[model samples]
Target: MSRRRLPELTHHGDRLPAQEERERVDMLDGRVGVEERACRGLLDGRLGASVFLVRSPGVVDGRGELVACTPEACSRWVRAAAEYVIVVNDVSAELEAAHRRAASVPWWRYVAAQRAFRDWKTIARRYEEVTREAAEAYEPVAREIGRALAEMVEIAAQERARQQDETRRHRSVLAARAFWGWSEVTEAGRRAVYVFRHDVPRDDAPEGAAPEESPHVDLRGLRRAIVDLDLPDVRWDGAALAETERELAGIGFGRWWRDLFHEDFRTFTAPPPARGSSSGRSSPSGGTATGGTGGFSGGFSCGGGF
Candidate 1:
C-alpha cells in the first residue's frame, strides 16, 4: 500500500518541512510503544550479530488498524530513519567471516542462521521498510502474518532435509593437499585415519595471502585417502555436519515459534506442520490431527525445528 502523509503539526510559529515531517512519521509508525512488550532473538552463531524485533499482538488492531502509537509522535518519526543504520566495515568480508563461524556449528543452529539471514534479508527488512514508509505516511497492507510464519517454518524444514542429504552424500576433497602446519603423510602413516581441516576459499582470503588451511590434529573423519602423493579418494563429510541422524532429528523449532509468536496465537500452540521432520516421530500438527492440518494445542513449545 502507498504511504499516507499525516499532516504536519506546527509548534508555536515554526512549521516542519515535508521531509522532516516524513521522518517524524517514520519513527512513530510501527514503533513499539513503551508499554508494549518485546523479545529479541540474536541471530545465533556467526551469521554476523544482527538484531531484529518481535512484538506482541496489540499495537496492531483487528482490522489491521494501529492503536495509540506514540504520545511523543512529534520527535519519534524525525529520528526513525536515523535509528536503523546497519554498517559493516566490509560487507563481503563480514559475510564470509560469519559464514566461517557458522561452519561446523550445530545443525540446528546452522538452520537457524539460514532462517535468520533470510529474515534479516526479508521479514525484518520489510518491517523496517514499512516503518519508514509509514513515517512517510504510507500505510502497510495488512495480512495474516501467521501464515507467513508458517512459510518460514516450511523453508526451515526444507533446509534440514538438504543438510541431511548433504551429510550422506559424497564430497570431493583434493588429494596430496597441503594441510596447515603439516602435510598429510597419508601414504606413510595410518590409512584408517580421517583428517579434518578448515580451508578458506581463495577469493574470501586476503589479497595475495595464501589461504590458511587449519588442519585438525584430531582425526574427525574415517575414509581411505591412503595413497601418498596421490589424490586418493578424499572427501569432506564436509565438516560442520551433524554427528548423527539422531542429533539431526533431535533439533526442534519449538522455541523459535514461541519466540516469534505469542502464546495465544494458534501458530504458537503446536510444532510446525512437519513435526516428524524435526521432532523425530511426532506429527507436525502435534497431538492427534483430528481435523485438517491445523495448529492448536493445550500447550506446545515452539521448538518445531529451528
Candidate 2:
C-alpha cells in the first residue's frame, strides 16, 4: 500500500527577495518549541543531549497511523546524523595535516599522501553538503514540523484511548469466550470446580484489587443454559467451539471472538493431567480432532478433542 503522507511543510507563494526570505525563515525559527529547538541544536552539533531524544516522536505506519518510536530508534537517527558531522570534521583535519607535512615527506610518500588527501576531500565535501542540505531543509519548516508532530502525538493518544475504551466495553464478552476456550474441570474440596485462567489483568483494573481472589465465572451455568434450550444433543467439543466462533463472526461479533488465545484476554485455568490419569484415559494431546463426527453440536466441554 502507498504510505500516507504527512502534511506538507514547505511554503507556497510568490518568490520572496533573499533578504525577505531570510527574515521569514528567522521568524519561523523563533516559533520552534522546546523539542524543535533541541532537535535543531542536535543537528547543528550544539547540544550533547536533549529532550528530543526522550520524546522520540513517531513515524507513519503506511496506513496513516502514527506508530510510537522507541528511544533507541530515535537515538539511531540522531547518531547517524552526528556521525556524519564528525566524519566531515575529522577528514578535513586529516587533509589539512597531510598538506602541511607534504614538503618534508619523501617523493613517493608525498604522492601517496596527495592521493589520500583527494579521497578525504571528496568524502568530507559530500558529508558537509549532506549536513548543509539537512539544515536548510529543516530551517524553513521547523515550526510547521513541530506543530505537525504535536498534532500526530495527540491523535495517537486519542486513538489509544478509543481502543482502551472499546476493550473495556467488550471485556465481559471476552471473558465469556475465554472461559469457553480455556476453562477445565478441576477438583476443589471434592467439588467439580470450573477453573478459568484469570492471570491477565485489564488495563483499567481497580487499584488494589484483591490479590488472593481469583477471577472466575462458572461456565457450568452456560452449559446448563444450553441444555435448558433443549439442545441436549449438542456436544460441546472443538468442532462446536469452531462453529460458535464462526457464527459469532457472522453475526457482527467481528474478529474478537477468535482472540481466545490472545495474551491480553486468555486465562490459565489449570495445568492438564499427565498422559495416564486415575480414570485410565490419556489426556488429549495436540489439537487433532477426535470422536464421532456425526450430527451437530454446540457450546463447550472439557471432554473429547478441543
Candidate 3:
C-alpha cells in the first residue's frame, strides 16, 4: 500500500481544536529553559507490548535570564546538539482487538467480551503477569539505550565545546576592536576596525606589555573558520536503530499474547520530549505510567529518521 504523507507539525498543536491547522515545529525548537533528551520505551496509541527509542532535539532555556535568541529562532547549537535514534511501536491489544471485533459487528462497540473468565480475579492476575513479563524482557533494551545515550553524551559535549569556542572567537574580535578604540561609542556610528594588534608598530604596544603568545582573532578569520568548519554530514544510524528494535522484539516485548502493537515500522511522531518528560516509562497495552505516553509515527528503520 502507498504510504500517507504527514502534514507539517507544530509544537503543542495537538492541544488545538481538531479543526485547526498549524505549521510544523522545527526539529530543534530550542526555546529557552528547555534541556536535551533521549528516550527508549512504550508510547501511547499502540496495542499489545512494544518499546520505542527516541533522540529528540532539546531546548536551551536560559531559565529566568533573558535569552539572546527569539522564541521563533531555532538555536544553531540545538541542531549541533541533536542526536539520531530509531523507534519501534505496535498497536495496543485493546485497539487491535477493537479492529478485529469491529470487522464483525458495528464499529461503535469495538471491545467485545472474550470467553468468560473462571473468576474476576483471574483477569487482573493475567494483566499483572503480562505487565511483569514485559518489564522483565525490556531490561536489555533499556540497558542498551543507556549505553547508547552515554556514547552520545560524549559526542554532544565535544559538539557543545566546539560551538562555544566558535562563539567566543567571533566575539573576541569585536571585543578587541572596542579595546583598541577602533569601534568606540562616538556620535558617529561605531567605526569598523580592520587593524590587528601585530599590525600596529611596536610603539603602539601598551607600555611595558610583553609580546603576545597568539594573535587576537579577527572578524575575517572568524568568518573564514565559520565557513570552513566541518559539520557532520549524516543522520542517525538507521541500521543501529533498527538493531536495538530488533532486540526489543527478539526479547518478546511485542509478542506478548496477541502481539497487537507489532507493525512493519513506526509512524512519524512529533519531535522528542523536552527534558522533564523526555525519559519515562509506559506499558504496551495498559498500566500505570510515570509520564503520559506521547505519540509517534515511523516510516522505516530507527535512528530518528522520517
Candidate 4:
C-alpha cells in the first residue's frame, strides 16, 4: 500500500499575504509542540511513541536522497548528533511496515516464552531445596567461621599498627645516619660537630650538648616476629554450619515461593473487621444484640427471677 505523506505548507514570497504566513507559522508551531509533547509523555510513562528526530548534516543529506542507513550506523549517528530534526513523511506506512516485519517470530523468543514458566519453577524449587539443605548443613560452621574471621581481623589490625611503628623507627634511623654522617663517631666527631652546628637543636638537649639517644637495634628480629605472628587458620564447628544452613534455607524458600507462584508473598492484606451499630439489645444468649437498641442501658428486665 502506498504511504500517505504529511501535509506541507510553505511561504516563500517576500510580500506574502498575512493569512498565508500565519498558516505556515501555525503548522510549524503545531509540529514542534507535538514533538515536545510526545517526548514529555514518553518520559512520564504516559505514552509509547518510538519516533526519533535527527538534526545532523548526514541525516539531512540522507533524507534528501531518501537513503536508509544500516541500523548500527543509524544508532551511532543518533548518539553522536547534538540536535534532532523532525522527518515524518509517512508515519502510518512506516508503522505498518514495522508491524509486518515484527509479525515474523524469532526462534529464540519462541523458545524463551515456551520455557519461561518451567524454568522459573525449576530454578525456584532447586534454589529452595539447596538453600534449605545448606542452611541445615552449614549454619553452625558459618557462625564459627564468622567469629574466627572477626578475631583474625582484630589481630591483623594490631599487627598492622605494630608494623607501621617498626617502619617509622627504621626510617628515623636512616634519617639520623644521613644527618650525622659516617665520621660522626670515629673521626673525633668533626663531621658530627659540623652537622650539629648546621642543624636545629634537639628538644631534649642544651644548645651545645649532643642529643641523648637510644642504642640502635637491628630490624631483622622485629621482621621475624611479625612474620611469626601470621593470622591463624580458622576452623568451623557443627553449630556454625547449622546456623548458616538455617539462614540460607530461609532466603531460598522465600525466593522459591515467589518464583513458583509468580506473585509477591511478602505483603499481607487483612480485611477490616465488621462494625457494629451503636444501639444495644439482648441476643438469644443474653449477649448484646448487634445493630439493636433495646438492652441493659435502656432498663430492660434482668434475668434475676423477676
Best by lDDT: 2
Full candidate order by TM-score, most accurate first: 2, 3, 4, 1
- Candidate 3 at residue 223, lDDT? 24
- Cand. 1 TM to true fold: 0.16
lDDT of 3 by residue, 1-306 (tens): 001111111111111011101322234333232232322222222233322222222322322111223433323322222211111112123323333333344333324322221222243345345544654565454454445446556877899999878755644433334211111111122211121134333322222234344344543342232223322111111222233234333322112211322221121123234356533333342111211121121132222211
lDDT of 4 by residue, 26-142 (tens): 112111111111211101223322222222223223322122333343343333211211211122223333333333334347554335434443443453454345334434433
lDDT by residue (tens digit), candidate 1, 41-125: 1222122221111222353233232223343542442233223222221222243344344442454565665654543345334
lDDT of 4 at 290: 18
Q: Whole-model lDDT, candidate 4?
A: 0.28
The worst-scoring run of ten residues by lDDT in candidate 4 lies at 13-22
**TM-score of each model, in listed order:** 0.16, 0.30, 0.26, 0.20
Cα error of candidate 3 at position 11, Å: 25
Off by over 4 Å in 1: 1-143, 171-306
Candidate 2, residue 109: lDDT: 67
TM-score, model 4 to reference: 0.20
Per-residue lDDT tens digits for candidate 2, residues 46-118, read: 4321112112123212222222333343344344334433433444344344333443344456566566555
